[model samples]
Target: MAQDPPVSDLTDDQAALELQRLALVLSQANQAYHRDDSPSIDDASYDQLKRRNAQIEQRFPHLKRSDSPSDQVGAKPKEGFGKIRHRQPMLSLANAFEVQEVEDFVARLKKFLNLAPQSHMRMTAEPKIDGLSLSIRYEKGQLIHAVTRGDGETGEEVTANALTIADIPKTLSGAPDVLEVRGEVYMTHADFAALNATQEQAGQKPFSNPRNAAAGSLRQLDAQVTKARPLLFFAYAWGDLSEPLAPSQSEAVARLQALGFSTNPLFITCDTPEELVSHYGAVELARSDLGYDIDGMVYKVDDLALQARLGFRATTPRWAIAHKFPAELAWTELLGIDIQVGRTGALSPVARLNPVTVGGVVVSNATLHNEDYIAGRDSKGDSIRGGKDIRVGDWVQIYRAGDVIPKIADVDLSRRPVDSAPFDFAEKLKQEGIEGKRAPGDAVWRYCGDEPLADLAIEALKHFVSRQAFDIEGLGAKQIEQFYHRGWIRTPVDIFTLKSRFGPGQLQQLCNLDGWGEKSAQKLFDGIDAKRSIELHRLIFALGIRHVGEGAAKLLANRFVTWEALSEAMQSAAPGSAAAAALVEIEGVGEVMAQSVVEPFQDPERFAALQLLLAQLQVSPAPQIDSSTSPVAGKTVVFTGTLTQMTRAEAKARAETLGAKVSGSVSAKTDILVAGAGAGSKAKKATQLGIETLDEEGWIALIEGL
Candidate 1:
C-alpha cells in the first residue's frame, strides 16, 4: 500500500520521509503476514503504527502528494469482473490506544474550533472485521461490480468471484439509482471450520485464521474454487450517489439493509456517554454470539451534520470516532499526575508514566480525573468507580477499554515504590498556584484567582466589544483583563467613562503599565471614542448578566433589538410582571437564564450605574433579521471548490442557516453550485450532465444580489 502524505505543516521533505517510512513498515508487515505467513509484527503493533501514520497525514494536508500509498487499497479484484471506481474514496482512521488519547483527541477537536468541552458528540459503534475489504457498485439500482480494495486509489476487478457469495447481491432490490457499498468479506469461524474440514478431506492446505482464510478464498485464481467457500459480506460503509439517500449515519446503515445488503444490525444510536458505554458493552458481551468474524466494534458519531462539520482527516472522518474491542493487554507504571486545564477551567488529572505496550500501542498516560478519583475515592466514594484503583509509581495492569484507551484494570500495590504516598492534589495545586480556581467538577484545580467575578466580567466585556458585536479595536481581552485587575473598570459601564479619566492629555499617566505604551493608550482611547455608537442589542448585552452568553444575548437583543426596548421590556416584566414572563417565552431563554437577565435589573444601584453608562453611549439597532435568515431561508444551493465568496466552511454555515443541506460527492438533489476557483471532481461531475455550476464571480454576484 502507498503511504499517505504528512499533514501540510510538515516540510515537503519531512512528509516524504515519514511517508516512505510508513510504507516500508506496512509493506514489510503485509508481506510477512500475507505472503510468508511469518509475521514481523503482531496485528496490534501493525495497526497502531498504521493509525499513527494516518494521523500525521491527516494533520499536514499540504504535504498530501498524489503519489502517497494511502491512496491505494491493498487488494486486487479477480481477473473476471469489470471494475468500477468508488463513488467516495475509502479512507482509514487514525486511532488511540488509551482513554487519555481518545479524550485528548476529543479535546483537540473542540479546541481547534473553540467549542465547549461538555458539548455533546454524536457517535456510532460497529465491529471492525479482520477480513478482506470489498466494494460493491450499483447503478440504476442494478448490480455493477464487486472490487477488492486494491491500493485505496486503484483495485483489481473481482466481480465474478464476489458474485458467488450468497450474502452479496447480483442485483439489489430497493437500492438507489446509483450507489457504492463498502464492507468486509469474511469467513466466519464456523464457515471456515466447515470449509477447512472439506479441504482436509480433499487433502488441501487448511487456513490458519479466519482473516487469512477469507483473503485467500477471495483472491483465488478459480472462481469455482472460491464459490465452494461460505464467505459473507457485511456492509458497513458506501458512497457515490445519484441522489440523496439516508439523512443520518444510522439511518443510512438501516437503508443499506433494506436495499438487500447484509448490514450489521449491531449498529445502534446512543445519546449520552453512559448510554454509549452501555452500547459498547452490549457489543462486547455478544462478541462470540455473532456468526461472522468481527475483530472489534467501530463506534461513529450518529449526527450527519456534526459528522460533516468534523469532516474527514486524510485517513478518517472527524464526525465519527471508533471504539474497537479489546485485543491485548500491556503492563506499565502510573508514574505521577499531569493535570490538564480545560476551556471552562475544569481540572482533569492525567497519569504520567514510563511508556509500555498495551493493545499494540505504547501508552504513557491515562486519566486520573480528580482528587476524589485518587486514593480509591470517587466523587461519591462508591467503590472508587470504574473498578480502577492505582497509585503513582505502582505497577498497573492495563487493557484496552474496547481497544480505544489503555484503562488501568488492576494495581499491584505490593509493587508500589517506597516513595509512593497518597497523591496530595491540594499540595500539587498550591505549588501550581491553581488552588483558588478549583475545577467545578471532580478532583481538579483551576486558576480562579482572588476575584472570580472580575475574571468573568473581563471575559464578558471582551465578547461584548468583539468584532461581531461592537467591533471595538484596542479593547480586546488583554485590555479588559488589565483594566479589571488595575481597578479602572468593574462593569460594562466603566468602559464608556474610561476616556474621561485616561484622556489623550493624561495618556502619560496610562503609560508605564506592564503592557501599556504611549501609542497603545492613545489607540485605546481612539477605539473607545470610535465605538461610542454600537448596535442597541449589543449595548443591552454589554451589562453581562450571569446566564446571558452570546446566544442568549443575541436572542434578548433581537427580541427588542435596542436598549430602550429591552429595558422597557425588563421593567414591564420585573418580578411577577407578565412582561417579564413574556420575555422568558423567547426561544433559547429558559426560566433560569431569563430570571438572571431580569433580576439584574431589579438591583437599583447596579441598574442605575448601568443606565448612567448607557446615557454616555450612542447606539443604533440592526435593521431587522427578516426571519428569512433563519436556517433554510426557503431556498436551495450547492457549493464546490476553493470558495472565494467565503471559506467552504463559511459558505456551508451560511447555507445551513438559510436552511440548505450540503452533500458530499454531488447528486441530483444538489441545487446551486457556488463553485469557487479550482473546482475538481465535483465540478466535473456537475458539468458532464449539464448540472448548473457557478464560478466564484457568479456566486458572489448571486449572494450580493440576495
Candidate 2:
C-alpha cells in the first residue's frame, strides 16, 4: 500500500510520521499515472487507495486540507484570449465525481446551510458544456457584443462572430436593453464532423476535439470568423441587468428565459445529490441525442439570497458544485493507425477500431494525439497499455477526454497473444471513409464511418432554416428534414417551393400523413414569401457558412454598400487575389474566416445559383434610422422607473434613434441621467455622483420637439 499524506492539524510528530509512511509511494504512483502516463494499478485498485486515504482523513477530519492532491484540477489554464473582469468573479465548483461524492456534496450543503437532512432544498442541475466561457451583451433587444473568459477579468471581444450560432437568439423576445449574459459556447457533434470533413478536403488540419472547436470559435479576433464556425450557447450566468432578478436560482433562469435568453433545458430542481445524480444519468444518456457537447453536470443552490450569504471563494463559488460524469472508457480492437493534420498544421495519429460502444455510444476510432502520445510510455517505461506499436488485432481501451473524441486509454495485455503483427496507419487510409466514409489522412482519429449520413444532411438543412438562421415561421426543422429526404427541396429556394412542390394530389396524400395540412402548407409558403424582402445583413447570414455571422455580414454589407459590390468583391480574381486577399486583409478576417469566405465563393455553380436566388429577394440597405434631434444624442443614458410623461417604450425609441448608447447600470461612464417617478437604484447611483439628474418634466422637455 502507498503511504498516505498526513492531515494539516497539530500533532506534528504523528503527522510527519504518517506522511513519511506514505509519501514516496503515493507521490510516485500519482506522478506515474498523471504526469508520466503510467498506471501502477487498474482503476478499481486505484480507487481502493484513494478510498483508504479518504478513510484515514475522515478519522482525522481537522487535518483535511484544501490543496490536497486528491482535490486538484486537471491541466492548468491555457494561455490565450484576454481576461474578463466579471462583476462577480467566476469561480470553479467543488466536484461530485461519484455517487458517494454527490451524497457528500449534498450533505455538506445541508450542514453548511443548517438544514435538516431531508429538508426540501430546491437545486438545479444543468449540463456543463465542455467548451469555452463567453459573455454576450445586448442593448434594446439587439446583440451588441460578445467576449471570451479571458483571465476571468478581461476577455477578447468576438461579437462579430458570435452572431453566427444558429441556436443563439439574435433578437430575443422582449429582450432587456441592458443585459449581459454568460454561457458556454460549444460545438455540436454534427458541426464538428462537417467542419473536420471540410478541413480534410482542403488539406487543413482538424481540431483536436470538439472542446477545442468551441474554444477556437469564441476566441476568433473577427466576429465573422466566429460567425462562420457552427458554435452554440446555453446561458448559465448573468451580469448587469435593467431590473433586479427573481429570488431563486430556478426563478432567475426563468426570468432569463422570459427576457429572451436561451437557457439550457435540462435544468432541474433537486433536494438531494442522489436525485441530482439521477438527473445526471438521464442527461448522460441523452448526450448522444443532444445538439452540443457536455462533460459534467452543474448543481447550484436555489436561493439567491442564501447564495449571496455563502458568497464565493477567490476562484469559485461556495453556492455551486460541478459533478463530472463517469469518464467515457471502452476496450476495443485496434485494427490500424492513421495520420491526420490539424488546424495548427500539426500531424497526429488516429486509431481505427472494430466498432464498439463506449458510454452507450458506438465509437469506432480514437485519437492518438501527438507523436509523443503514440511513442511515449509510463514510468518503468512500459508500453502505453492501449496501442504503443499496437498490432493489427490487439484489443485496446479508449477514453474520451471529456464527451468529445475518443483517445487511447490502455490495453488488455492478458488478452493479447504473441502472434499479432504491428498495425500501420498510413495504409488504413486507402481503405477508410469508403464504406465507413472515413476520409483520407484521417489516421490520428476517426469518426463513425457508417453513421447514417443521409440523416445528417437532413439535419443540416433543418439547421440552415432554423429560427435563428432565417426565422421562417411556418417551416419547422423536422418538416425541412422530411422535405429534403423526400426530395421535395434541395436548396433554400426549395424551401420557397414547398407549397408549390407538393401538388394538391400530393398534399392530400400528405394531409393523410401526420402533422400535415392544407392550412399549414399554405402558411409555410406565406412565411417563405414574407421573408422575400430580406435585409442585406439577414440574407448574408442565412447562407449557413461556417463562421460568417450576422454581425460580420452586417459589417460587410455596410462596408461594401450593396449585394453586387460585396459579391463582386468576393468574386474578383484581381492581382493580389483581390477577393481572397481582400477578405484575408480585412482587419478581422484571419486565416479561418478568410478561408471560409473564400471557399464558398470559390464554387462558381453554387455562387451563380445563390446570386440568382438573392436577385429574387428585395434586400434592405440598412435599417431606417428615425429622424431625431433629441436631447440625449451622442450621450450614454440609462433609463429607470415608470415614466408618466411619455411611455417607457416611447422614451427608449426616441433615445435610440438619436444615436445614443442606452446602457443599463449607473456606471461612472454614464453621461446623461434620465430619472423618472419610482426610480430606485439608478436614482441612488446618480445621486452618489453630482451627474445632472432629470425628473419626468425635465426629461420631457429634452425630447419634446424630437
Specify the highest-TM-score model's number.
2
The backbone clash count of each candidate, in order, is 48, 38
For candidate 2, the 10 contiguous residues with the lowest summed lDDT are 72-81
Candidate 1 segments exceeding 4 Å error = 1-22, 30-41, 51-83, 108-115, 326-706
lDDT of each: 0.65, 0.64
Best model per lDDT: 1
**Local distance difference test, candidate 1:** 0.65
Task: Give lDDT tens digits, candidate 2, residues 123-175.
Answer: 88899876777778777878877766654555556666677777666766665
lDDT for residue 132 in candidate 2, whole number 0-100:
70
Clash count for candidate 2 is 38
**Candidate 2 — what's its lDDT?**
0.64
Q: What is the TM-score of each candidate against the true structure?
A: 0.42, 0.44
